[model samples]
Target: MTSSNIPIATPTFGQLLRSPVLLLAFGFGSGLAKKAPGTFGTVAAIPLWYGLQFLSPVAYLAVIAVTFALGCYLCGAASKKLGVHDHGGIVWDEFVGYWLTMFMAPAGWLWALYGFVLFRIFDIAKPQPIGWADRRVHGGLGIMLDDILAGIYAALVLQGTAYLIHML
Candidate 1:
């Protein structure tokens, strides 16, 4: 049954903590927040993004590839468990989305902050292809696609802003 027809089963925080897929899909418990779970999920990604800084650009890209694949599976699994597709609690998408947005960004906390803002704006806005993917895609891949597009949009804007700043 579709989530709308059936009652959605809300997992307890402890249940979420116990399941690896749920834990990752929930952005390491950031999704457990009573409000703005997506925002918190994105924030939870900061440490990961910071850790990624040590990798070379190529390695970073590789990690993103693996993470995206994993996100799709975990997010889909979580959605299935919750009886919802792309539920708010399935926030692994946001983590990877933010990471993609910050790919090759200027090296600094300020730049990361800027990337975070831009990613959030684009993800929330869902312009063009992102909106299209959100509507058209389904399953695990769908969960990741829209956010990936949003991240790309954010990355473009962030890169342009950084370039302009550099010029100035």
Candidate 2:
């Protein structure tokens, strides 16, 4: 069958939640949104970031490490089941990416919002290495890698901006 003609099966929300991988891959149902699922997934990430924000830097890093690993597995598995690579519904990457973007960010709603905006910008823009990874990678690691890079890029910019503001 032609690539376009291949059938892609998307699991229902009930089906997705039945599996740990699918549940996370769908961003706890945020990815099931009829419109702008990625945006919804990112929004869902905000509260998680808030909860995780208080972790010590070392603990935060540990959590990010684990989340990235879990996201890679779950995202890959869900994409395989859905018969699509990087399906829009596979948004665990977005969740991890946003959390990483806000890592160690100063405590404030404004900072959180800024991190959200910057992460979404970099993710959607897919500039440089992020775009390269997205195009060339496959499977679960591939699914999570691009967003991870985007998050790192956003984190750098966010941290640098905070530093500059402090210096000023």
Candidate 3:
């Protein structure tokens, strides 16, 4: 929701396709926080993480893989329609990205914290190719690719953390 007395006009389905505001608004509304939407969006993955962790590591990886692939298409179309790239609310990329970050970490608070920090850092920093992808790509692929990079970064950091602490 925009923070103004002026009401936002609703876009038709056609218009929404040209604008990312609608889809991102819907996705990030899952958090509904006035504070950092990205942090809240990452927290929003907790319940999902609990449910998904029941499966094996391979299953978790598969889920992230499939979700990322599908999100690429969906996010690209939404961004194309909205004419803005990587609007804040389309945190489906964030969701899968965090899940992927957690892939190597063992299930527990330590692993969760590691995932949270690494994903948040990479997501916020948008280092190297992440920034490149965000700027260069258009549509859903653009929206999703940076987070995938974030996930990979987080995964590596988690691996290093595990080694440092001897958790691996």
| Ranking, lDDT, top scorer first | 2, 1, 3
CA lDDT scores, all candidates in order: 0.88, 0.89, 0.72
Judge candidate 1 against the unseen true structure and give its global Cα lDDT, from 0 to 1: 0.88
Query: Which residue window of length 10 is worst by lDDT in model 1?
Result: 1-10
Q: Give residue 51's error in model 3 in angstroms.
A: 2.1
lDDT: the better of candidates 2 and 3: 2
Which candidate has the highest lDDT of all? 2
Write the residue-wise lDDT of candidate 2 on 136-158 in tens digits.
99999998999999899999999
Clashes of 3: 9
* Candidate 2 structure lDDT: 0.89
Per-prediction TM-score to the true structure, in the order listed: 0.93, 0.93, 0.77
Tens-digit per-residue lDDT, 1-168, candidate 1: 233667355566888777888888998788888888889999999899999978999999999999999988998888887787888877899999999999989899999999999999988988898899999999999999999999999999989998999999
What range of 10 consecutive residues in model 3 has the weakest lDDT sum? 1-10
Q: Which sections of candidate 3 miss by over 4 Å?
A: 1-25, 31-35, 80-83
